[model samples]
Target: MQQYNSLRADYKFTEEEAKILKDLQPRMEELADQFIDEFYDYIWGFGQTAQFLKNKDIIAHHRKKIKEWFINLFCGKYDMPYFMYLYKIGEIHVKIGLPTHYVNSAFTFVRTFVLNSIEVHFHNKEQHLKEINAVEKIIDMNLDVLTSSYREEELSKFLSLSSFEKTILSGLKKFNSYVNLFLAGALALVAFFAIGLFVYDIYLLFFSDIGIEKGILTVLGSLLVLWAAIELIHEEINHLQGKGFAIGAFIMLAMAALIRKVLIYSLSSEKVDDLLIIGFVIVSLAIAYWLVGVKKKANSV
Candidate 1:
C-alpha cells in the first residue's frame, strides 16, 4: 500500500487524473476487443509466442484476462488491490521465465494503442490532452509495479543466499570482470600482431621472390585475418558493455585464420590434404557461427 502510494505520488497521479481515467472507461471498454486482437497480432510476430500461448484454452483464458486488465486500466480504482493485481501478473511472468524485454515491448504496444484510440475518440483538445496525460501516467505506474516483481524476485534470491555463498558470488563476479578485462587486453594484442602480420606480408610481397599472384593473395589473406581480429575486439567491447559474449566472433576468427592457411596452401599442390582439412574446418566453423547467430536471435525474441 505504501509502495503503491509512493508510485502514484511519483507519477503525480492525482484524484482528478483518476476521475479523468474513469470518465474514459466506457470508451476503453468499447475498444477492448480491438486492442486484444491487435495485441495478439503483435505478440505473435515475436516468433516465440506459441511457446507461451501453447493451447487454445490457455490462449482464450489469457485473452479474457488481458481484456479485463485493459478495461480496468481506466477503472479509476488505483489502490492497494489494483497495484497488488499488477504485481501478481508480474510474478506470473517471472515464474514462466518471461523476459523483461517482452513485458516492456508489450507495454509499448499498449501505450501506443490507447493513445491512438484516445486521439480518434476525443475531439476536445484540452480534454484529450488531460486524458492522455492520465493514461500515460497510469500505464507507466502499472509497468513500474509489474517490473518491481522481477526486482523483488532477484532481491529475494540474493537475500536467501548464505553469507558465504553471497561472498563467493561477489568474488566470482569480480573475477569474471577481471577475466573480461584480460580478454580485452589479449584481443588488443592479437590485433597488434595481426597488423604486424599484415605489414610483414606486404614486405614479403614487395621484397621477396614470391610471385605477384601468390604475394597478393597472401596479403589479402593477411588482411582478412586482420579484419577478423578487429571484429572480435569490437565484439569484446560490446560484451564488456553488457551485450552477449560473441561466440560467433571467435568462430569467425578461426575461420579467417584457416582460410588464410587455405590461400597459402592452395599455392602448393603437395599440400592438397592440408588444404582439404583446413577447408573442412572452415565449413564446420561457419555452421557453428550460423547456429550461434540463430540462437542469439531466438533468445532476443
Candidate 2:
C-alpha cells in the first residue's frame, strides 16, 4: 500500500537531486546502449549467470528493457509510478529465481557506472562534486527502493496467509514435531532406496527376465514414478517445516508422472483412450507450465 511519497521519505530523495539528475538526461540517453552492453557483457562473463539467459531471444528482449530503464533514470521523475515500476523490476527478478547476491551485485555495478559517468563528464568543474553527489544519492535511492520492494513482495505472502493457519503451524506439540521428523527420516530412506532402484532399473533393462523392449520402457517409467514420489516427499517435508513448496516444482512433477505413465502404457495392455487422456493431461500441464514461466519472466526484472 506504500506509495512513492511514503517510500521517498525513507531515502530522503529531494527536488534538488531530481533536478540534477534531470540535467543528465541527454547524456544518459547517449550512453544508455554502452551502459547496457557493458552491464550484460559483465554478466555474460559469469557462466552460471549466462546459462539462464541461454535463449538469445530472452537476452535480446531483456537487453532492450535494461537500456530503456537506464535512459529513463535521468528523466528526473522519481515519483510513485517510477517507484512501482522499479519495484516490479525487483519482483520479477525474484519470480524468475535470481538470487539476492546477483541483485546486490547488479546495483553495485550500476552505481559504479553512474559514478564513473559523472566523474568523466564533469571532471574538475565547480559542479563536478555536486553532480557526483546527486548521482550517488539517486543510485543509492534506487537500490533502496528496488531491494526493499523485493523483500516486501515476499513478505506480503506471509502477511496474507490466515492467522489461524499460521497458528496451527506454529503451535506444533513436541510429540507432533517429533513425529514429523520421523516422517522426514522415513521419506529420506525411501529416496535412498529409490536411488538404489535406479541401479536395479538398469539390471532389469539388460539382464533380468524383462526383455529389452519392455524392460527399457517399464524400468524408465518406474524410475520416473519413484522420482515423482521423492519430489512429493520433499514438498511435504517443506510444508511441515512451514517453508512452502513452489508450484512450479509440482507442475514438473506432474509432467514427470504423466511421462512415466506413458512409458509404462506404451508396452502394456492399456486402452488407447486412456493413453490419449494421459497425453492430453501432459499437454495441458505443459501448456500451464509454459504459461506460468512466461508470466514469471514477463513480471521478472
Candidate 3:
C-alpha cells in the first residue's frame, strides 16, 4: 500500500486524473472487444504467442482476462486494490517466465490503442488533451508496476541466497564481466590481425609473381575473413552492452577462414581433398549459424 502510494505520487496521479479516466470508462468498455481483438493480432505477430496461449481454452481465458484488464484501465480507481491487482498480474507474468520485453511491447500497443480511441471519440480539445495525459500516466504507471515484479523477483532470489552464496554469485558475475571484456579485447586483436592479413594479401596481389586470378581470389578471401572479424568484434561489443552472445558471429568467422582456404586451395588440384573437407566444414558452420539465429529469434519472441 505504501509502495502504491509512492507510485501514484511519483506519477503525480491525482483524483482529477482518476476522475478524467472514470469519465472515459464507458467509451473504453465499448471498445474493449475491439481492443482485445487487435491486441491478439498484435501479440500473434510475436510468433511465440502459441507457446504461452497453448490450447483454445487457455487462449479464451486469456482473452477474457485481457478484455477485463483493458476495461479496468479506465476504471479511474487508482486505489490500493487497483495497484495490488496490477502487482498480481505482474507476478503471474514473472511466474510464467514472460519476457519483460513482451510486457513493455504489449503496453506500447495499449498506449497507442487507447490514445487513438481517445482521438476518435473525444471532441473538446482541452478535455481531449487532459484525457490523453491521464491515460498516459495510468499506462506508464501500470508498466512500471508490471516491470517491478521482474526486479523484485531478482531481488528476492538474491535475498534468498545464503551470504556465502551471494558472495560467490557476486564474484561469478564480476568474473563473467571480466571474461566478456577479455573476449572483446581478443576480438579487437583478431580484427587487427585480420586487417594486417588483408593488407599483406593486397601487397602480394600487386607486388608478387602470383597469377592474377589466384591473387585476386586470395585477396577476396582475405577481405571476407577481415569482414567476418569486424562483424565478430561488433557482436562482442553488443554482448558487452547486455545483448545475447553472438555465436553466429564466431561461426561466420570460421566459415570465412575456411572459405579463404578453399579459395587458395582451389588453385592447386592436389588440394582437392582439402577443399572438399573445408566445404563440408563451411556447410556445417552455416547450418549452426542458421540454428543460432533461429534460436535467438525464438528467444526474443
Best by lDDT: 1
Question: Clash totals for all models, in order?
Answer: 0, 3, 0
Give candidate 2's whole-model lDDT: 0.77
Clashing pairs in 3: none
Task: Compute each candidate's TM-score over C-alphas.
Answer: 0.95, 0.53, 0.91
lDDT (CA) per prediction: 0.93, 0.77, 0.91
Q: Could you tell me how far off, in angstroms, the CA of residue 222 lies in candidate 3 after the best superposition? A: 2.0
lDDT of 1 by residue, 1-301 (tens): 4677688888988999999999999988989999999999999988788988999999999999999999999999899889999999999999998888889999999999999988888789899899999999999999999999999999999999999999999999999999999999999999999999999999999999998888988999999999999999999999999998899999999999998888888889999999888888888999999999999987876
**Residue pair clashes in candidate 1:** none
Residue by residue across 1-301, what tens digits does model 2's lDDT show?
4655776667676787788889988988888888988998777655467656868898898999889888888888888788778888877777777777777888788888888887787656868877777777777777777777667877887688799976765676666778878867876787787677778878878777787887788778768867876876877677687864446656876898689778867876755788999999999999998998887665453
Per-residue lDDT of model 3, residues 1-301, tens digit only: 4777788889988899999999889989989888999999999998877889999999999999999999899897888889999999999999998888989999999999999988888689999899988999999999988898999999999899999999999999999999999988988898899889999988998899998999999999999999999999998888888888888999999999999999899989899888888899899999998999998887765
Model 3: per-residue Cα lDDT at residue 137: 98
Please report the TM-score between candidate 3 and the true structure.
Answer: 0.91
Error of 1 at 1 (Å): 5.6
Error of 3 at 8 (Å): 1.8
Candidate 1 residue 21 Cα shift, in angstroms, is: 0.7
Best by TM-score: 1
